[model samples]
Target: MQILLVGAGLSGAVIGRKLAEAGHSCRIIDARSHIGGNCHTERDADTGVMMHVYGPHIFHTDDQEVWNYVNGFAEFLPFQNRVKSTTQGAVYSLPINLLTINQFFGKTMRPDEARDFIAGQADRTIEDPQNFEEQALRFVGRDLYEAFFKGYTEKQWGCAPTELPASILKRLPVRFNYDDNYFFHRFQGMPKDGYTPMIAAIMDHPNITVQLDTPYSADMTATVDHVFWSGPLDGFFGYDLGRLGYRTLDFERFTHDGDYQGCAVMNYGDRDVPWTRITEHKHFSPWEIHDGSVCYREYSRAAGPQDIPYYPIRLVKEKALLADYIARARATEGVTFVGRLGTYRYLDMDVTIREAMDTADAFLNCARRGTAPPAFVTSPD
Candidate 1:
C-alpha cells in the first residue's frame, strides 16, 4: 500500500515508520523544510546550545510504553521542569506550592497549615464552579488567582478567565507541598540530541520516503491508497466553513553572556509585561555546559494564515466550527485525521504518539482484513 502521511511531525513520522516497517510504502510530506514540525530543535551556531526552535517542549508522560518508544530514537536526559513566575515585584515558584504560599503571605506554614489556610481562603459559597475564574476562586481563592493566574491567563489566552472553561484551569495543580515540579508525570525527560534528530530517526526506514518543503493537496490524495493528515483540521478543507480559532506564539530571540534567567522557564504573570514568558534555551539541556546562553521572549496572539498555529482556542464558538470540520473529515474517504491540529485539541507529546501508534495499528489491521480504516481512531468530539 502506498500511504500518504501529511505533516512530518511525530504523528506522521511514527505512523509512517510503523506502516513502512509492516511492508507498506509511505510518502510523508511536510510544508516546512524541517521534519519535526513545531517540536523542531537545533544547536545554536554561536553558543552551541541546543535550541528548541518552536518553543520549550519538555517530554513528560506517565505512559511507560510511550517513554520507552521515544527512547529507541534518541537518548533522553533526566530533566524536571521547575518553572518560576514573576508577579508584582517578587519571584516565586509555580503551581502555587507551599514555598510560594509562604513566600507570598510572609508566613512559614507547613504543608498541613498551608492546606488549611488555602482552604479558608477558598470561596465556599460557590458550590458549583462554571468557568476558569470560578474554578480558581473555588480551588486556590482570589489572592493566588489574581497574583499568578489572572494576568497570565489574560495575556496567554487573550481573554478573561470568566469566559474560559473550568477545564483549562483544572489541569493546573495547587500543591500543598514544596514540590515545585511543573508536571506530575511519572516519566519526565528531554531528548539529548533534540527533537529534530529523534523524529528523523523515527522516519528513517527503507520503505519510508520523506518529502520536506512539500505541502499535501486534495488532488495528491488520489495518488495514494490512504492519506493520514496531521495538519490543521480546517486547513485540509481550505477553511470553507470558517477559520477555527487558534493562538499562535511569536518568539523574540536574544543571546546573553553566561546566564540570563537562571531558570529554563520564567513566566511573567503581570499583565504589564508584554510577553508571557522568557525561556533560557541552554537551561533545557543542563548536561551541556556553555559560556553563552540563548533565550526567547514568547508572545501569544490569534493565529494568522501565515503564522504557525500553536494552541487551539477551543472555546464555545470554535467548538461549533470544529464540529463542522469533524463532520466533513468523517465523510471524506481515504483520509485519517490524527494529532493535535488534526483533532483541534491541546495534546501532550505522549498522547500524540500513542494515538499515532494506535492509528497505524488500526490501519494495518483494516488492510489485512481488506477493509477501510475509520477517519479517526480517536474522535475529535
Candidate 2:
C-alpha cells in the first residue's frame, strides 16, 4: 500500500515507520521545512548549544516502550524536570509539593501536618465545583491556587479559571509529599542529541520518503491507499463545522552571558505577570554547559491562523465542533486522523507515539483481510 503520512511529527513518523517495516510503501510530508513538528531541535549556529526551535520539549515518559523506542536512535541522558515558579514576589518549586507548602505559608509543617493543614484550608462553601478556579479552591484553597495555577492558566489559555473546565486542574498534582517530579511517567530522559536526530532516524526507513515543506491535501486521497493525518481535524474538512479552538504560544528568545533562570522552567503565576513561563534550554541537559545561555519567555495567547497551535483548547463549543468533524471523517473514506492536532487534545509525546503505533497495527490487520481501514483509528472528541 502506498500510504501518505501527513505531518512528519512523532505520530506521523511512528506510524509511517511501522507500516513501511511491514513491507508497505509510505511517503511522509510535513508543512514545516523540518521533520519533527514541534519537537524540532537543532544546535545553535553561533554558540553550538542545542536549541529547541518550538520552545523546550522535555521528553519525560513513564512508558518503557516509548523510552526504548526513542533511545534506539539517540542515547538518552538521565534528566529530571525540576520546574520553579515566580509569583507573589518569589520563586518556588512547582506542583505545590511540601517545599512549596512550607515556603508559601512561612511554616515548618511536615508531610502529614501539611496535608491536614491544607485540607483545613479548602473552601468549605464550594461543594460542587464547576470550573478550574472553584476546583482549586475546593481542593487546595485560595492562596495556593491563586499563587500557582490561576494567573498562569489564565495567561496560557487566555481565559479566567472560571471559564476553563475542571479537567485541566485535575491533571495537576497537589501532593502531600516533597516529590517535585512534574511528570509521574515511568520513563523520562532527554535525547542525547536532541529531538531532531531522533525523529530523522525514525523517518529514515528505506521505504519512507519524507518531503519537507509538503502538506497532504484532500485531493491526494484518490491516489493513495490510505492517509494518516496528523494535522488539525478541522483543517482536514476545511472547517465546515467551524474552527475548533486552539491555544498558540508566543516565544520571545533571548541570550545572556551565563545562566538566567535557576531551573529549566520557571512559571509566573501572578495575574499581573504577562508571560506564563521562561524556559532555559541548556538546563534541560545539566551535564552540558556553555559560556553563554539562551532562554525563551513563553507567553500563551489566543491562537491565530498564522501562529503555531501548541494545544487544542477543548472547550465546550470546540468539543461540539470536534464531534461534527469526527462524524464527517467517519463518513469520508481512505483516511485515519491521529495525534494531537488530529484529535485536538493536549497529548504528551509518549501518548502520541503509542496511539500511532496502535493505529498502524489496526490498519495492517484490516488491509490483510481485504477490508477498508476505518476512517479514524480513535475519536477526536
Candidate 3:
C-alpha cells in the first residue's frame, strides 16, 4: 500500500514507520522544515544547550509499551518535571502540594492538619460546580484559587475562569503530601539527543521517505492509497464551515551569561504579569553543564490563521464547530485523521504515539480483511 502522511510530527512518523515496517511505502511531508512538530529541539549554537524550539516537551507516560517504543529509537534520560509557580511576589512548588499550601498560608501544618484546614476553607455550599472558578473555590477555597488559579487560568485561556468549564480544574490535583512532581506517571524522561533525532530515527526505514518544507495539497492525495493527516482537522476541509477556537503561544526569548531562573518552568499566576510562564532551556537537560542560558517568557492568546495553534479552546462554541468538521471527515473517504491537530484535541506525546500505533494496526487489519479503515482511531471528543 502507498500511504501519504501529512505533517512529519510524532503521529506521522510513528504511523509511517509502522506502515513501512509492515511492507507499505510511506511518504511523510511537513509544511515546516522539521520533523518533530511542537516537540522539535535543536542545539543553541553559542550556548551548546539543547533548546526545545517550541517550548518544553518532557516525555512522561504510564504505558510500558509506549515507553519501550520511544526507548527503541533514542536513549531516554531520567527526567522528572518539577514545575514551580511565581505568584503574589513569592515562588512555590506546583500542583498545590503540602509544602505549597503551608508556604502560601504561612502555617506549619502537618498532612492531616493541612487536609482538614483546606477542607474548612473549601466552599461546601456549592455542591455542583459549573465553571472553573466555582470548581476551584469548591475544592481549594477562595485564597488559593485567587492566588494560584484565577489569574493564570484567565490568562492561559484568554477568558475569565467563570467562562471556562469545570472539567479543566478536575485535571489538576491538590496533593495532601509534599510530592511536588507535576505528573504522576511511571516513566518520565527526555531523549538524550532531543526529539527531532528520535523522530528521524523512527522514519529512518527504507520504505519511508520524508520530505520537509512540503505542504499537503488536495492533489497530493489523489495518487496515494491512504492518507494519514496530522495537520489541523478544519484545515483538511479548507475551514469552510468556520475555524475552531485555539490558543496560540508567543515566546519572548532572551539569553543570559549564566543561570537565568534556576528552574525549567516558572509559571506566573498573577494577572498583572503579561506572560504565563518562563522556561529555562538549560535546566531541561540538567545532566549536561552549560555556562550560557536561554529562556522563554511564554504568552498565550487567541490563535490567528497564520499563528501556530498550541492549545485547543474547546469551549461550547468550538465544540459545535468541531462536530461539523468531524461529520464532514466521516463522510470523506481514503483519509484517516491522526494526532493532536488532526483530531483538534490537546494530546500528550505518548498518547499521540500510542494512537498512531493503534491507527496503523487497525489499518493493517482492515487491509487484510478487505475493509475500510476508520476516519479516526480515537475520537477527538
Residue 371, candidate 3: Cα error in Å is 0.6
Candidate 1 per-residue lDDT over residues 273-317, each given as its tens digit:
999999999999999899999999999999999889999998999
lDDT of 2 by residue, 1-381 (tens): 899999999998999999999999998998889889999999877666788889888787777887788888888998888889999998888778999999999999988999899989889798878998988899988888888888888898888889988777664357778899987777788988899899889988899999988766767878788898899888988877778888888889888888887788999988887888899888887889787888898888888877788888888888777778888988988888899988888888888888998899999999889898887777665
- Backbone clash total for model 3 is 0
What is candidate 1's TM-score against the reference? Answer: 0.99
What is the C-alpha lDDT profile of model 3 across 1-381, one tens digit per residue?
A: 999999989999999999999999999999998889999999999989999999999999999999999999999999988999999999999989999999999999999999999999999998999998899999999999999999999899999999999998775358989998888999999999899999999999999999989988899988999999998999999999999989999999999999988889999999999999999999889899999999999999999999999999999999999999999999999999999999999999999999999999999999999999999999987
Residue 303 in candidate 2, Cα distance off native in Å: 1.1
Q: Which ten residues in a row have the lowest lDDT in candidate 3?
A: 167-176
Better of 2 and 3 by TM-score: 3
- In angstroms, give how far residue 230 of model 2 lies from its true place: 0.6
Ten contiguous residues with the weakest lDDT in model 2: 167-176
TM-score for all models, in order of appearance: 0.99, 0.97, 0.99
Model 2, CA-based lDDT: 0.86
Q: How far is 90's C-alpha from truth in model 1 (Å)?
A: 0.4
